[model samples]
Target: MPPTATPESSFSETAVFGDPVAQQLLPLTNGRFAIQTVHGFAIYDEADLMTVAQSIPVEPPGWPNSTLSASAEHLVWRDKNGRLFVQRLADEATLDEAILLEVPGNPNGWDHPSFHLSPQGNFGWLFDGEAYSDEPPVVTLYRLQDGAELVQFRGGLPQFTSDEAFFVRDTAEGLLIYDTTRLTEPLYTVPRDEEISIWDIDLTADWLQITKYLRAEKRPFVELRDVATGELLHTHVMADDETRVTPSPDGQSLAVTFKQDDGADSPTVVAAGVRLYTVSGELRHEFLAPQISPVPIPSACAGVWTSRRSDPVYSLVSVDFAPDGRSLNVTYNDYVATPVTHLYATDSGEKLAEFTGHESLFVANGRSFISLSTDGLVQQWDTATPDATPQTIARYGTPITDLALSNNGELAALVNETGAELRRTADGELIQQYAGATAVTFDPDDQTIVLGFVDGRIQWRSLADDSLLSEMSDYAAPIRRLAYWPNQPEPTVLALAENDCRVTRWQLATGRQLEPLHTILTFDEYGDVIQMSIDDFTLSPTGNLLAGRSWFMYGFGVWDLSNDSNILTELEDQPLGVRDLAFSADGRLLATGEAWPLGGWVGPERGGLRLWQIDEDNVSLRWSTELDQFVGAVAFSNNSSLLAVGYSSGDVTLVNTHLEQFVGRLETVSGVTGLAFAADGRLLAATTRDGLTHIWQTGSP
Candidate 1:
């Protein structure tokens, strides 16, 4: 019987919850700062840390310092295709249209290209070349107001003056200064000594600060020179371990991060703190904090060492002067402790305030806000009470690899490399955790939970008391998938290994192993028969049919589990790869999603979702729709009336099975990793790669 078409329904997003990976915190004008996240930039007022505006581009930019840059007025970035984007900041809109500029020449050979925004946001510069090439790198300067190239040159690193009147480029001979109005020739050249190599350069209105490494002494030093005359004013020789010299905005003082050497015969080097100094080499103050103990180092020389400091040694990640130069912001590495940002007086060295740098966002009940941060702390703020403090929920040292929701929506299973955990969905409370777990799933009754381990073992444990019910250890490879069969006499579980081409079945009730089922076989390019391994798999509702997607063969196949016979096989001859497949509830329809072979970011040439009609012995294509993004996941509704397709571009589409038309579409902040529908078909859930899980209501319009 043909499945009925799903009625027209209104899909509304309910809640989105997750922490975005924060890339960097950039200080802007007027005590304002911007947090560069994976999605885009979030500007906040530093006084109260309130969000002023959010600037998300049409296509999210790459990581900061690589392909993304921002100023107070504009944001510049590069897409995956090396096309530069310039967006203007606006007070009314969170997202603004950006002008896309396709860079000339093929960027395929470019290595580690980066973008830089001018201090005033009027210009953008792109640095592209081979990382270790002998030739000089290419630098292209663009006028931000319009996508126009002003000049293109070959230089190592380009630094723009604060006033934007002139810019300097580091070259083999010296620093070549150029007037912004005319780039025909260098205005002046600051010559360098043969033994000195520039590591970093900061240009200001009156002075130029350069960090240079002395080859003879094997030490680094900071040099302050006159910007107009190109004459060295003062030079400060840093300690053997000191680095990262950042000049103040006014170019009067400099902040240097240094490591302290323990006074032993074979001294251990540890990052002590930042040192504030004037350009004339006058020490202002030492901004020292508690340090984290360094890891034990293996050395040939041994000496008796006694510590004078009682606090653990911690490393300083970065030190930045405030826009006004009155205070300094110090950040510490978060490996040994919670990440903290400390503000200190420049002259007095008085500690002002400490912040976790975690932004507290209050989103509307049904509206979605996407964020990503590097920190592992997770907290939930009460939207009902505006001034209430947030409650800390859970802290994860490692990133979440996979997530699954129970049938009743009461429990959520999260998997990482080290273990799998079950948390209550109501308040995000941890219930149980299993170490060495790779994958996890729940039974239909929600009473028994099945877990797959990296050691090729499967455990079926009771959810009520967290007791082991059954265990199987037949395979020698890591288990990747664990699913329970429905409508079976015994509670049977199927397990797929990461390196095997067969699926092993185990009966949980009697703890007995069933016969393994092999996937389809196909002919290779050399005309030899080869067994295709499944990269993704799905089972029919009745457990009588199974579908497997072969990533290597760029095809998918269906097999009759009752007879262990391959019933249908389809292969694409192009460079398209089948990503996911799902079987309808009635076992009469199948849906498969495909995408380009090269990560799906290379222009949308080929990829989409296809629906196939499955008969007793034959399968026919019902309809196919081409998409602009890679399809990451697909699932069928409980009644097989609606098919939900998820894409790498964070788009989720609901399609009517019988009509072959789209019912609704939803967008997320990142690529969708998993998709599922509730048993009653009233709710749909989608998990994104950025650690966010979104839930939506499926109801009549």
Candidate 2:
């Protein structure tokens, strides 16, 4: 039998729960059966355990940060928008009745809503439910009954003495509870407010648990306390935060899963590593799980849990943890918005090894290209004979944007909200700093750096001495994209405005503005021109052809540069509508990526990727291929024999032109922004959204 490609059998195990998961319950519920899987949420139904609900048709942008909560009445959760929702499994088509649970005028902002539902349908709790003391440890609590406001409180609630009362939230100072038998005050009070976050509480038994958290130390501790007598029953400190702590069916030992850090940008909390902790604060046994870390880095306190037997860490993007937590689920870097690294192991807290195989876009030598992932560092590849191992260049604190490479490829410039930094590619050292730069590029002469802003302004600086090259341009709108003609001798530049569909060409030396070329709109409603490249401004390749994407309509075509009209047939309504546009090295073909589509707005895998055999002779599509995944970027190696495709899922596939078969596959990277083939045709460089770059080489030429 052919080998089956099942999810990590052990670490990525699917636990059969009672009901189907409602993934739409963002932030509050972990979405259906399997919460937050790469493709979508794994939902389960009460009928058959193995059968799971598939992800929704639409894909969300960026890494998904979700929280899940399961209640008998409904499943709830939140998405990146911080919106709260409830999902009912009865009818799959009903998507209404979502409530915005964010409170009015909460200082903590709407992003952090302390929402928790009780399994007993008592009341829900929001905020701290205490009077605002205007201090570091002020606690306020809001009570909810049947999803409606029930009561609000300042300080601690009145203590309860009945067996039907149960605590919902706890702090060092006190505990909040649901009083089945109404009492004027059914809350218990502790002495202080600092040292604890109540993970669970049982008011009837006069028992509560304070989960201790230390961020810098990456450790999580728990203490069992007697609420009635303020007695510390037992204190247990674990190596890291416990991804899940579920009391055994008999309530003797707590099945605990410690969150281990996998070296990926964002690690998922996984099970495979399980421990049984006695309620008396005793360690019964810790199942030694396999190690999955690529390196021996300590855990950074990130983890999650599905059951007492299953614990996994969640990542920003997507990840796969192996069964035993020993072998790695081949790390797919930049596989999604933020990249996810997964470690396979049996123990939830086992150290797992991970490798990142993705690249980022950066600036070098006044040219912008994708960087290859060489080890953990970023490197740059020259288009000329680009086969060499991209020389190791700079290291960014996180990812970088608006990188400006000097003409000689010696110095680099980059920016983020914190400001901009210019560094040397050779030694990865900082050269200068600037404020508020959105776009960075090098001048054609490699003598200066250009800085574009969000406020419709552009600035330049001389590279030789880091002096101001020219006064900033006071354009009408933010410069969305900037490109310098590839082979131009003088310092000429193209500026894209965010406010309108206009491409402005400016000659730096003469300050001469040519009549805006290709300003006429092809579609009634203007389309977003994702990217624009210049080869020979004379339109020699395809007879006055200008290639780009149109707004609302994702289409790829060559337009008559003189008239701004479509030359070849246009492609429209594709999900990822022209994330990137590339002309084959021979200029006989054009490729467009289906990645970076305006997700959350549309769904229809419309050609995941398509290659048009440029009928330059007739100016039409000769032939094309239908891709399956969302293509983020595309490139044709110099010889045009191999087509490199980078996908939003971080999967990179190299396909042969003649047979259109897969030639090679690289590690999954985040959304690929740009692709550049080396001059030698043997290497490919891919740039990702995470601000890292990578170089890919193959054994076969």
Candidate 3:
């Protein structure tokens, strides 16, 4: 059965970025820029030189941009999971995300594609740069000139050649060229008898170049097709056993290299030749291999890693004539760790100092170009001046996964591999930083912050003064959570292990362990008194009851927090699938959810919720409702009137506890990981594993 459709939420919306790190930056009109993070996008005005102001959050978290817009009033980006999204600049009020496409589970076929935004930003070219080995390649051509989609299709990226007449697509049928003016119909189609595999495809200003190996003929071939009509202009084939073909940037010359089998049974290049051709396939000039000193990675520019020496580690391979055909460039084609491109004089064999990167180069001009390195550093190179040293625009900050500029371009926010930071953009100076933090909790006064690191390091800091107060580092295990206590005189921290049942208390200012108590007393399958996992647990707002899931026992338990660390009651039924549970604000009603049962007679018929009425000695079940999918999250309203449940299938059901019936449903593509009710019972929020938080208002009308 199909899931229920979620209606439009009527509650007002405001996005929250919890220590978000910016990954990409795109400059827009009037000194405003879009700072993109793995979670969301923030538009900031750079009116002030030092202070960032009026920063507004737009789009949902987890909507990352593969490509960004500059002049057009829209944002174009693809999420890390290969979901495409486009949003108009004007409509910033609602959840109006236009989902462009979805890449399947295995996105190997849809990798490394470039987002081609038109000069005016009205149109966008959606594509995969390389062809897939299994399925037919597809692309979408979107015309968003008027902020509405004009035309889009499943094909290859649009071809905007100098002739501006045709674009090509590799459909299941075959390679077909279509008229740019009329996008729906193909003007010419390349005939094919059987299935064919293309190695590399290049569309230049005046021609279409396709490189493929024909198994029937036992040879590799490069075919040049005419742009006006998809007719084969020329076919270059290898006569020897092993050969490599490289087309020039202008699509005029084809460099052919013949290889011989060395003693190791590997192909060794012994002969090479460059064959020049005209637009009509006429042979222009042929140049053979010449002896010369090869260019290397400049001594001034150091490689990113230890393997990146001052000199070239590998030979200058894969030769291709430059656009002007005056010199030749030897570079690596595949995406390698340490990538470098060298320029050599093809005729004189003189070494040149120019070495570009593996991917696209940011060419400022014909002689000068800029490129973003594989290590996320910006590099500038000048081809005209051979002796000029390389200039690094932004020095790389290692261990930081992402970085972006603040609203006013005065500061930069970075998501560190371990934590997060705010740095000065001008000099790369560290301003404020956190160390190895996995989770953070603030005190009620908002003056103290307790941080839990993955390495089991717990520390306290003053949020008002940005000073470290105390820290502890001898937990023997990583800390999973840190909670701040408000009713204490000195700051107190409650830390829980990632998988254990003990909650350790520590003095925030002294860094001293106050006490260690086990929430659940249990023995393993061997009946030993050991640290059994409290698979799932939650405390009531009034601290009256502490409920937990007993994985090995195949049931859940309730602890009397007011008395001692003892299980006041236990319910033996369905095992805890996700350890999902919640209690009402008054502590009188408890809502517990169970996951799918393991290898047993039970199934999802038992995967549902059970309402419990808490008493002094024991708890009694009120009612239980079976759910469709395994439970992932559960929550209750502050007033104890409504119960919200989330499933592994991303389905959320709102139930009226008074009426014992489900009233509404919320559906999400990404499964829910967390759920909560606002303090005043005004907002209901749910968070996904992909970092998306959905919050809406719910109250009695």
TM-score of each: 0.56, 0.41, 0.44
Model 2 misplacement above 4 A: 1-434, 442-449, 471-474, 486-489, 524-545, 560-576, 595-607, 615-618, 678-684, 695-701
Consecutive 10-residue window with the lowest summed lDDT within model 3: 303-312
lDDT of each: 0.67, 0.45, 0.55
Please give the range of 10 consecutive residues that has the lowest summed lDDT in model 1. 298-307
If both were scored by lDDT, which would come out higher, candidate 2 or candidate 3?
Answer: 3
lDDT winner between 1 and 3, please give it: 1
RMSD list, candidates in order: 12.4, 22.7, 14.1
lDDT of 1 by residue, 491-585 (tens): 99888776466777889877798887766435455675555566457888788888876645257777787774545544433224777788888
- Identify the leading candidate in terms of lDDT: 1
TM-score of 3: 0.44
Query: Which candidate's TM-score is highest?
Result: 1
